[model samples]
Target: MLLTIIYIIAITAEAMTGALSAGRRSMDWFGVILIACVTALGGGSVRDVLLGHYPLGWVKHPEYLVLTCCAALFTILIANWMRHLRSIFLLLDALGLIGFTIIGCQIAIQMGHGFVVSAVAGIMTGVSGGILRDILCNDVPLVFRRELYASISFVSVICYWLCIHFGLTLEWTVVTTLVFGFSLRVIAIYFGLEMPKFIYQDDDEQSASSKDI
Candidate 1:
């Protein structure tokens, strides 16, 4: 029940963000709705497809699809007021990231997967929606550049696994992981903490070799 509530909130937040992105690009209402739906549900769809989990979440629960579309339209209605709620939006996005991560990790664990697969599932669920949103908006994917986003998702997965391994109650594990992950993300944003980028400037030799090709 807790997870289901969080999932709804997460998708709503994600859809709103996606709608905002489309608005920034001057997209029409149809584009906004399309981006919103993809951003809200693309990650889980991808995960289910990869894992061969039959019936994607939105497919099984058409209400979720309706909710996302509603959220998208609502965002468009309040677009003028959104700038004042930037901080709130960021916090909601953080919460969504952790919620998505915990939900994904739990699903994988229930499927009898081990640590690594669960970790990947969690990270994918947490970040891939935003990636699709950015792609649709023609912006670089925030997951690849945002401060501690995907890493925090992975850490949340590890935290969830450790809690379960130590025999924590499922409810407590979910709560703890959500608190820890959300706090970490908030701190990262506050401090502008980021993973070091790997810049590969083409040296003269490499440039020449590429030119020859």
Candidate 2:
């Protein structure tokens, strides 16, 4: 039930963002719907496959299709609110990331996976759908950028595993993990936290200058 709520919220948020992007690009309705669908189902599909869940979530419950269509309709109507959409994009993405990660980790643990694999599954669940959306929408995936976003999911999953190891209730563990993941992501965005990059320097600048003289 919790997973269903998370799926609906995440899909709706993704639909809104996707609709804005598609509208900005002047895509047709077909393109908009395609992006919205991909954004909504891509991550969960991959996670389910990894966890050996056949037919997947949306397939087993066709109500998810109805929900996705509703989300698409909402996005189309509210497409004019593009600026406000951008303003809330980061926050929405963070919420989706935290929720999906927590849900994925919980599912994996329930299936008897160890902490390490559960964390990996959580990371995959958090980022893969966004990657699919970006690919379909012709943009770089946010996870592949230098940002600390995906790493935040990893850290959150680890914390969740620790809580479970200590025998915390599933509900409390999920709640705590969601809070930790969302907070970390919000902090990273606020402070512009990022991974390091390669730097290069001239090794023979002095010798080259003397020879030029």
Candidate 3:
């Protein structure tokens, strides 16, 4: 029940962010719903499909689909207010990412998967939606550059694994992972911390490469 509530919150926040992306692209209502659903559910769907998890999430619980659509429409109604609240959205996005990762980890563990598979499931749960969103919006995927996003997800999964391995209760595991993951992500955002980038450059002006990305 707690996990289900968290999942609802995660999808709602994600759909809001996705709607903002759609608004930036000046999409119609249909486009807004499409992007919102993709951003909110795409990751979990990808993970489920890869793991051969039957029935799928949205198929079993169509209410999630309705929630995303409603959240998208709500975002559209408050578009201007949203622009002024970037930091709030950032925090929400961080929460959503961590929440999704935790859920993904739980699902994999329930399915009798091992640590590595759970970690991959966690990462996919975190970033698959963003990848689809970026591609649809015609922007380079955020996970591919300029941020510690995907790495944060992987690190969170590691933290969750450690907590479980150390014999922590499920509640403690969830709280620990959520706090650890959220802190890392917000700190990364605030300090502009990121992974080292490898720029592919020609021999000519090879040293002209910059690190702005």
lDDT by residue for model 2 over 1-213, one digit each (tens)?
Answer: 665676678777876666666777788888877777777777778999988968887898878766766777778887677566674877877888888888777778788898888888888888887788778767887677757978998999888878878999878887788788888888888889997766754567576666555
In order, the Cα lDDT scores of the candidates are 0.91, 0.78, 0.92
Rank order by lDDT, top first? 3, 1, 2
In model 2, what is the error at residue 91, expressed in angstroms?
1.9
How far residue 136's Cα lies from its native spot in candidate 1, in Å, is 2.0
Tens-place lDDT per residue, model 3, 79-176, is 87987898988898899989999999999999999999999999999899999999999999878896799999999999999999999999999999
- Of candidates 2 and 1, the better by TM-score: 1
State which candidate, 1 or 3, has the greater lDDT. 3
Look at candidate 2 and tell me the lDDT of residue 198.
68
Residue 210 displacement (Å), model 2: 32
The 10-residue segment of model 2 with minimum total lDDT is: 200-209
Which pairs clash in the backbone of model 1?
A: none
- Which sections of candidate 2 miss by over 4 Å? 1-3, 198-213
Give the poorly placed runs of model 1, Cα more than 4 Å off. Answer: 208-213
Q: After superposition, how far is residue 153 of candidate 2 from its true place, in Å?
A: 0.9
TM-score (C-alpha, index-matched) for candidate 3 = 0.92
